[model samples]
Target chain A: MKELSLNILDIAMNSVGAGAKNIAIALDEDDDSLRIVIEDDGCGMTKEQVEKLSDPFYTTRTTRKVGLGVPLFKLAAEQTGGSLDIRSVPVSESEKEHGTKVTAVFNKKHIDHTPLGDLVSTMVTLIQGNPDIDFLFLHTVNGKSVRLSTAEMRKELGDVPLSNGEVLNWIKEYLTEQYKEIERL
Target chain B: MKDKVALREEGSAATRIVVGMATCGIAAGARPVLNTFVEEVSKAGLLDKVMVTQTGCIGICQYEPVVEVYTPSGKVTYVKVTPEKAKRIVEEHIKGGKVITEYTIGNK
Candidate 1:
């Protein structure tokens, strides 16, 4: 993907497809590298699934489209002399806690490093489609941070859906303002 | 734009336009299609009547940037949708209630 945000969006969709009720996207950035950790409380994948994720062909051959998102992310990271790590626990009825966690570390100073695009739009699109799901986004640049949690919003909103045009607009503004605020830091 | 109170009372929008937003679709430019639908639908004052949303790819890699329109009757799947086509869809199929067969998946 041209933009890191697009890669994040694509990967997040996998979490959503996995029936995740709660998804957390965290970006920890500094002068050296940008680390993205996307954790999901979904019906996790098996060991085989996790192992096969890096191979582009294995994913595309399967019907579910595991190939496109992960491979692109791995390529993007590897191009910058960084790496992608994936850990998953297969869904087990006996175990209540099971999900997937993906981490991609990118060398910020590398010439091939893909820049983070409009992440605010990515967040809006995710919330706009899946209002029922809880999405928590946190970005920490140096020491300053910007965060949003739909779970917190639901407490204040009562019956108001996140998909509401008004609410989505507010989220867009909130994130955009936070991004601008981060730039001043 | 409807407030929280009015949006809750009326329930969700009656019609839905679902854009495929997976890697395949996004790579093929689904984002513009989605934004265009949302913009044109709102521009036509049809937000109350129609809602533009997104979903993961539905396994159609070749015919990506797919959009599906759902109404009272059924769904009409449009393939390889662009920003311009999204606007026409809102004006003709959505607001005008005339389906554009040429852009549909079955056009082949």
Candidate 2:
């Protein structure tokens, strides 16, 4: 909640919980606004469920009473003169593909907006935690862009585990370097 | 829970400390707990010796902010771990090579 990356991580966990094998997370930051869009090929919610998601008390989990991920994210975006949108198509729809998409837009210069935080760590953690899940991370800052995909990495890695400390360290460094390159562009 | 399996395979490190970072765990304030562990481990010059990482869910949300320490011998699960407790864990359990009984799951 403190950082945009943390909120992204939190929402991605929900995607994982929804049985998403492929999750695409995109962050677009420019002079005007910072927008994050997370789209997952997971078991999507029904219209009713999507409607109830804005409620702080609404949660599918049986463990605790409330689910704050959606509401908190919505609040964060709203505070920054932005908005949150969630779209989901049910798995039962034969004609339509089943998935969920969460988009949050925050004003770039908003005083209340939190920093991005350790985005490299967040991405590495997600990839390390769920190696089987394919994650595509695209970050575009002021029109300069960089993209990282686990599916591609997995093909290159072959037998080596993604969670391997060496590989994780490499990922962190790779992201940092890529961001620097993008920033320079 | 399933994520831990992938991490378990990366067994090259001498020690592995897993902090729960799932929604439940994070809501219970696991970020600070994780940050503390990473800071302490690095401060102690145990970067190569200890691998501090995170997992999604541990299945027990009630005992959130859960931390699991995997030594070469076995694994110890600690629940309700705070940043303060995380430092003590790094010092006593990780450095001293002794599990802090008071912080172990079900004990606290």
Model 2 B-chain TM: 0.87
lDDT of 1: 0.85
Candidate that scores best on DockQ: 1
A39-118 in candidate 2: lDDT tens per residue? 99988888888888889877555623227788888989999899999999979773358999999999979889878887
Off by over 4 Å in 1: A60-65, B1-3, B8-14, B72-75, B100-108
> At residue B90, what lDDT does model 1 achieve?
88
Local error of candidate 2 at B18, Å? 4.4
Listed in order, each prediction's TM-score against the native is 0.88, 0.78
Quality class of the docking in candidate 1, CAPRI style: acceptable
TM-score, first chain, each model: 0.95, 0.93
The lDDT for every candidate, in the order shown, is 0.85, 0.82
